[model samples]
Target: MTDLTDRVKQAAAAAEADSPPPVTDLAVTDTALHWLQSRQSYFTDALPRHVDQAHFMSVALSIMPALVKCTHESVHTAFLACARFGLEPDGRQAAVIPYGDKATFQPMYQGYIELMYRHPRVDSVHFGWVRERDQWDYTPTEPSPRDFFHKPRVDLTEDERGPVILAYAFAWIDGKRSQVIILNRAQAEQIRNKYSGAYKKAERNAKRDSAWHTDFDAMWAKSAIRRLVKVVPTSHELAELLKADDDADDTTTAPPVIRGTVIRNDDQADNADNRTTWPAAAEPGSGATADTDGGEQA
Candidate 1:
């Protein structure tokens, strides 16, 4: 009798553990959609830091409200020219400066560590994903940890862990939006080609799931439905509440560094006075279109 009672208690505890605490609102999905519509510079604006601690969105491109032309490099160039024109004689350093990755992936781990360090005080941060490749440089024939570690550049598989598709990034719930925008790109074109399907699917899911949950079938029977929906902006009573945005800056937010990529800037803070504040465009540039490889590098 006592043994039966103990077993009942154990089973109840397991059931409680299995259920997540009452599904506290899906916030990520909604804000990203709105922010994607009308981007606000205040969101992307970072509080200037040292070079080592600097994380920036270099404005690789911009898709305005109406037409569709991605003015990435050239616009960024214009921004720089504006900065130069507005350079101050007696000035403070600018919030943004040129950025590049001299050491590959070092910033990634460092950024991750810093986030972890902020254990309990973290309010919100916006994390983004950019799937760059589809296949690993080397494929593993076995299922061992080492197989995963020293995977063969050839002989890849059709697993989620196989190749990356479209390396994309958007807003998330960290401290700030694009606070840690990660750009994990490789030099392999085939890698980008492989995961193209997954990225497209992700984009589609993002769009569809931007609203509240609708599909009832998955709640009942599916084994693995990601069921990821963005937290709705309407849910937040506080405009000050951390909101995920999907603007050109957010959806296509680029980190200062990726695979040794570098951006050089020498502007002062007062230069904001002269910077061109163009509204979000509709499409990418004449040279820019939906990347045949997958999503654009924005």
Candidate 2:
């Protein structure tokens, strides 16, 4: 057999023979290192290191399960971002929700946009967040001319003349038509409440932190975009990679990471400040919208 194949078999045998009781202590074999190296093209940022030896072990344990339920390609793509975002690995997908938290596992804004356009039928996807103007506004980005025919529309509606924190827009298309949906501060909170177990730890901190209180617009936008991809005509592969998110941490159904295992300034720590905080706008002097190439958007 080829050297690489032989190395992988040897590593698997070692893992099976001495599988440590602490999942986090499992080694990152040469095979996994090779896998990570081979998938570099799929990522944009440098992948974050494991928070500790335990975190590395958890990642090692995750590899086999990811490969089994998620196809090799799917697990590879999911890990590309998971490593970057320091997300906990689920079966086919990865979790953004901190261990034992109740809010859904939403991706970082950049990851959210990337997964959207990764949809084969998706011509393009753009994101906007609430601004200081007492209305929801987004960066005014134009899709490529080829996509102008079915550009997704983003806008807000009025209820009683007061700022409608809740807004709906046509954010996605199935290559056939568009889908209008609602994304608002209320919905995000509702989601958090629905997955209350996951937020129990964060909710206590949110009461003290202005960061969480002030960033609802960006948070709502991400929540909306994540929901949009699942309901639309994305690739089956992309969908499978994200499917585990539907009821993340709501029950014992999820794969476990090191729960109650705290590391100071831990990369996996769920602090609001350490989390994905959205900037007020994507660019200065640009309209309320942020344009990104499936990466960071305003």
- Name the top TM-score candidate: 2
The global C-alpha lDDT for each of the candidates, from Candidate 1 onward, is 0.25, 0.41
lDDT of 1 at 7: 59
Residue-wise lDDT of candidate 2 within 1-298, one digit each (tens)? 1146656777788789996332322233333344333333333232334334345335534444223322233333334445444454442224332221122333444555555565567776655443223433333353422232221223533333344355443444655434444567767888656653434545665542221343455455556766776566666444533544433423445432222222121112222222222112222223323222212243
Identify the candidate with maximal lDDT: 2
In candidate 1, what are the lDDT values of residues 38-137, reduced to their tens digit? 2223222322232221122222122111111212332233223212222111112111212111100111211222332243433433332222233233
Give all TM-scores, in the order shown. 0.18, 0.38
RMSD of each: 23.9, 20.6
Task: Tell me the lDDT of model 1 at 17.
Answer: 91
Root-mean-square deviation of candidate 2: 20.6
Q: What TM-score does candidate 1 reach?
A: 0.18
Displacement of residue 221 (Cα, Å) in model 2 is 2.1
